[model samples]
Target: MHNDPSNENGILHSWQQNAEAWTNTVRDGLIESRRLVTDRAIVDAVLDGQPRSVLDLGCGEGWLVRALATRGIQAVGVDAVPALIARASERGGEFQVASYEDIAAGRLPLRVDALVCNFALLGKESAERLVASLPSLLSEDGRFVVQTVHPLVACGEQAYVDGWRQEGWTGFGTAFPSPAPWYFRTLASWVGLFAETGWHLCEMREPLHPETGRPASVIFILQRH
Candidate 1:
């Protein structure tokens, strides 16, 4: 949770090291909640808008990009981890290696009708900068969509106060690599973030697990104001 220079490096290192393991596990349906609920929520939100081209920020393993392709939507996937991007490239989609800072600085050269960040807005600094840059990243009428772990469920035993959180590798077994750091923000803070960025929250929904009835993730569909 420490906001030091090493934190970002640590996160990238962990993901890089764990890319193949993470990809293999996710592809094999290791996380049932994501496979069943959150994944569908993200795809449905984008399809409902019917965007011609989509930019998937921090798209891991290119699963979502592949899914979108099957639906006739062109998606460009970008991630900081080279290994993940490589795996994504092998999946037959346009994948790029760009950090969140690259996107914030307008270094990534592309524009799309919609941008999706699926469980990828990990840190406060990057998240803030990225939100501020969304106006330039999307088309005039494009939407910014993000699906994240529901604060209520994500908070679990931790304090609701916004801060750094080292992910628990418990669910992925020992084969998983280093734990990554992510910021935990309350629902109120999430709302405030978009509002400060001059983006309006046009739609919001909590994707719930059909069998357990527990919310898996929260989707926020936003528009430039």
Candidate 2:
């Protein structure tokens, strides 16, 4: 298995390659973690803030965007993968294809009440750039919400620290040829990054799987300091 996990562009390339299978898996609700817990965890997190408008930073296939729209909130989506953006657009709401570099460069010029990244922060440089630029992308009091794989649980046999980590999707499905690797950060690292980026962690929630009762994902609710 080839995981170009360390390179930022290589990570996007991997997502592009797996876009179809990923879309299928997401739409068909094949991923057990998402189906049972994390999906609702993200949606409810955003709704709890009661933001009039939301920007889903790495929204794939637009499920979260559509879900928010049903509650009468305007939702927009941006993603690097063309296929993923197309799939999201077809489903509904405003969906755009823009790389994190473009967005970080101030190309995305809409400030909303809330900015969200649902499992979208993947690469080291890319994630850093986007988070650092978030203040400009959000309204004066806009909040930022993020959902990611729980660092401790995801650390597996590796040392519990910050680095690039790769995981195969064999448990999810056999259709994926090359799974995209994600940058991993510890709990303290995450809070430090947010502070360094001019944001403070407001709330942290761990969404657990119903059956196993282990955390499926970790949510960080943040606000500009």
Best-fitting candidate, measured by TM-score?
Answer: 1
**All candidates: TM-score:** 0.96, 0.95
**lDDT per residue, candidate 2, 86-129, as tens digits?**
98888778999988898999998898999999888878878988
The superposed Cα distance between candidate 2 and the true structure at residue 40, in angstroms, equals 0.8
Report the alpha-carbon TM-score of model 2 versus the true structure.
0.95
Which regions in candidate 2 have their CA more than 4 angstroms from the true location?
A: 1-6
lDDT of model 1 at residue 26? 81
Per-residue lDDT, model 2, residue 190, is 87
lDDT values of the candidates? 0.89, 0.88
Top candidate (lDDT): 1
| Model 1: per-residue Cα lDDT over 76-159, one tens digit each | 999999989998888698899999989999998898999999999988877898989978989988999999999999899978
Of candidate 1, the 10-residue stretch with the lowest lDDT total is 168-177
Q: Give the local distance difference test score of model 1.
A: 0.89
